[model samples]
Target: MAKVKSLDDLKKIKEEFLSKEELQKNGDKSLGIVQIKVAMATCGIASGAKKTMDYLINELDNRAIDAVVTQTGCMGYCYAEPTIEVTLPGKEPVVFGYVDEKRAGDIIEKYIQGGELVGDVIPVNYETIEEHNIE
Candidate 1:
């Protein structure tokens, strides 16, 4: 990567990096697939989330899976550290913990490709504001 010479250059680089997200956001034909979000907070980085993220992105691409991989902030499961949330189209999202390289591959090969759960899933015990009305 070349050094950014100005704000325009930086913006161009950012756009390149987020091209996949842009496609998903615009609903430009890549919809109805999988959405993957990797926890990338400080704690997550310390626990090797970056590697897990890279593994997922590369593996998914190599396997020709239509998915958008994004990075997100802390999920409040510090004990879980490197975690990922995968949401299949028309289905509830599922979070998995301790996502090392091997586990990431398993997730891709099994959960993402075969539609079977095959990792340490972090159960969702609460509903989001979007899921239900709150008084």
Candidate 2:
């Protein structure tokens, strides 16, 4: 193998591998705003998780929303197959369940863009922890 002669050659190679154009074109910045994650569990995948993922990617690309989409393992909510997680800047992450392509669109539109909570919220376990007992 040919050794890199100098810093300039290494830089050129690095530029090619991590090119701005390529990053913008293929990196996880297409959404340009939020980050999306779909739980591709066995049940989720069986229930068409990939389709939902594609819908989100296409929708974001079509609308030119800057965001990144990733896949995760079982979210432990198997009953709610095809679950999704949305992480907005400066906000707590939200997990949605029983999501399909249509619901995916709704999520993108309502939560991601409109900032309105959509339907089908995964019921959370709220335990009241008494901070201090009054005398």
Candidate 3:
């Protein structure tokens, strides 16, 4: 870490740290924004989820898209390692598998930006507890 030389520098460092902390927390849920969760478990990492995530972060920022890219644990789709879950505001979340850098770009361009569905969609097989009213 670089030493802060002045108050302005300290503020900049704090802002940067807060930004990274927000990404790690994955709690950005502002309405009307896209939310992306990249699976980063052991299998996911081995399959290059880190690269995929970096691509997503960079592409989204480059395109000036309003999106939150965050890391998540295993999505239980080990067969489809490097998976990602995308949630458009006011829409249900969609899970896509086998994501690479190219595919990540496509996802941002087509799905996130253009509001179109792309390939490699993994169907949601399990129901949430809310669906079953198991409270």
Candidate 4:
């Protein structure tokens, strides 16, 4: 591989890389896919969350899974940078922390495919709960 000389070269290199990565993405066009959310707060960015988020987007696109990848504000998980939330269609979103390539892969395979929970989880909470137990 040669060094990127210009913007055009960089674009070409990226395209090639995406093409190569897409070959391994087998869940293309699979229905009932899950959506992914990566925290992109100031803390997350400082902890290399941007790169992980980009990697996830690329990987998802390569696999051709129709997933929505977006960012969220601080989830109070600054210690676990590069955190992500995977939302399956019928289930609530499951938050994964300290995510990297390996965890992302595991998420795609185990959680997404198997419908099982991963190691780390960030519970979804609301600011307040309404009392619905009226008799």
By TM-score, the best candidate is 3
- By lDDT rank, best first, the candidates go 1, 3, 2, 4
In Å, residue 103's CA in model 1 sits off its true spot by 0.2
| Model 3 pairs in collision | none
Off by over 4 Å in 3: 1-31, 133-135
Quantify all predictions' global Cα lDDT against the true fold. Answer: 0.87, 0.81, 0.86, 0.76
**9-112 per-residue lDDT for model 3 (tens digits):** 99998899987655534443453568799999899999999999999988888888777788999999998878999988667789999899988888888998
Comparison by lDDT, 3 against 4, better one: 3
TM-score on alpha carbons, each prediction: 0.73, 0.67, 0.74, 0.66
Model 4, span 5-112: residue lDDT tens: 999999998899776545423334354556687889999888877887888888878877667788988778887887998877656668899887778877877787
lDDT of 1 by residue, 24-52 (tens): 54553347668999999999999999999
Compose the digit string of candidate 2's lDDT tens values, residues 24-53: 444453322476889987788998999999
> What CA RMSD would you report for each candidate?
6.5, 9.7, 8.4, 12.4
Model 3 / residue 42 / CA error / Å = 0.8
Off by over 4 Å in 4: 1-33, 125-135
Indicate the TM-score of model 4. 0.66
Better structure of 1 and 4 per TM-score: 1
Worst 10 residues of 3 by lDDT: 22-31
Error of 1 at 11 (Å): 25
lDDT of 1 at 91: 66
Could you tell me how far off, in angstroms, the CA of residue 33 lies in candidate 4 after the best superposition?
4.5
